[model samples]
Target: MRLAFIGLFFLCTTIYAKQPAVTPHGVETPGVQTLPYVIDGNVKVFHLIAEPVEKVIYNGKINLLEEFVKKNNRYSGPTMKLPVEIQKIDGWGYNGNIPGPTIIVNQGDFVRFHVSNHLPEPTTVHWHGMIVPNDQDGTGGTADPVIMPGKTAVYEFQIVNEPGTYMYHSGFNDTKQALKGLDGFLLVLPKDGVDLASSDFAIMLQDWAIPEGSEQIKYLSMDRNWFTYNGLAAPNFPVLVVDEGERVRIRFGNLGLMSHPIHLHGYSFKITGTEGGPIQESAQWPAATVVIAPGETRDIEFIANNPGLWRLHCHVLHHILNDTSYFAQHQKNGIFPEGGLWTYLYVKPAKDQMTRASE
Candidate 1:
């Protein structure tokens, strides 16, 4: 009887010892299951081998010109000018345009951004999607220091992530600064140069509002009554010129408060890539309208097989108007042709393109 009791006690104690300990949040088991949240010691570890920054060419260099400008005398707009040239837009933008300069770089290339702030307040540039080193990140207090008024700062990082569409914007006082139109894009082209075409383009959709004829944007108002593509509303929106039968790539990005379902008339395009990187060919699908949400970028490609002046605009009815400029009666039947974020794609005939090519 004494031996039987001793054996039974030992068996119960052994069984209890094998049971896992339950904590409020996790379970602590034995061996590989010691900690539910902890990484297994026996798991294989892999390191990402990147090119040395010093040995690679820092080919893409940009100078950010962040400032407040008075356009049309009464309208106030924020702008960013890169190198004071390359491209310039009147709408609130970096380097003097809305949707700032598209920083294009080959995969594995190094990039250097020299930011100069001419705004009334301090600011910093945050690489929106790329994995930059903590110190190079422009998060102001937590990462790099801010660029004070009339001061400059530099941010350097390598393109180690997969080739895709990313973005950059004011990180300091983001609520006010970014809302005031201080943002742009970063395009990483694959080194192999797959799907390279002459018709590649980039467009950024943004919203704005000023009191009727006021030249300055309503910085405090959430109701952005004005809409634009690269800073100009429709009737003034730039036309995308392409040739018939040519493969065209349009890179679309949105930094506004609303998502835009951009409808491309007469063509079903494939979303080839996004901020996350190029989607595999087998996984790509076709759509007539691609939706771009806030802080997101998408790349779509299609062959311009049909030749004509095709309308490209946001499908949302309200996105087709600028403030109270349009009357309910005027748009009761269809969208007013002279307002909103609409643009045209002038797909010329093959013969026309050839004739113009020689000139």
Candidate 2:
């Protein structure tokens, strides 16, 4: 316990007053902030200071994977390296955290965030799902890297747009970081507001790799070859619970660039929304799982039907492993032809495990 407290204290002290520029004579940078939830309340803000990152990928020289290798270096890409923070043994995983944090927001509101660069280079944020300006679009040049180290840039925009499941990530090197863990889920509630009592819930599915005994956190390595749902692999699956007889909505958002045919072992939900945002009518589809593509969003709703412990995961079993090779090496391995788990739906419904409590 003492060690945990000490670690937390050190992290707070460093980040609280962390000046840009990662190293001496480096680019002095500011801090990054973010807005947790965009409710109807007064303006609220949050922050995230991104520093330059470098990572290493150890590719396996076995099987078909070797065919994808480039000149002794199995891994070949524009940038396989990324800045990574080691785990502090308290909530902090190698790459900072798991499932990251739940991003909250509501319909008809405004959100302003100042993304500061602590790294020696440059970076920016892109509001993945929500509609914003070409500038607040949060990308490189399209918006702008909030200045380099030592400086700060703020992204201001009205959340005056569609809501549902959305995403936000480093638009600077989106093709890379965004695919990694640099992204989080965003929820835009309705005008009347969101109802936690019986209405909304969210789940973000991602697969990451943190090489054992290394300060570097590689989002995904084709070689490490481990997969997880919301960062959890099978057997380590999370149990989602709710009132047995109540109506419930499961908001599944796919932040990974790969498509996930998420199957619910038991309950079937209504495909109520898509990446384009919420569907107008209750145009419903009854299925155990739904196909969700990256940079895309989907919302599913269903009454607490045959409730029991259910498994909600990407139909891509390999992804159920690590998302590494599923995306990094073989694009074909990433594709789902003729509506497989990557296209169609799968369900394994059972009875509720919780006893009916007498009121």
RMSD of each: 22.1, 16.1
Off by over 4 Å in 1: 1-92, 192-194, 325-335, 354-359
**Positional deviation of residue 112's Cα in model 1 after best superposition, in angstroms:** 1.5
**Cα displacement (Å) at residue 133, model 1:** 1.1
**Using TM-score as the measure, which candidate wins?**
1
- Residues 1-359 of candidate 2 have per-residue lDDT tens digits of 99999999999989965643221211100011223434336654655555543321212211221222235543344432212122211111112434444556667666666666664446676777677877677667654544566666777776776766776777766555555556666666665653422534565665444554443446445443444344434333324445555556666666655667888766656788775787766566688878877677788777665644344556766654323443444454333211111111111133423342111
Q: What is the lDDT of residue 341 in candidate 1?
A: 69
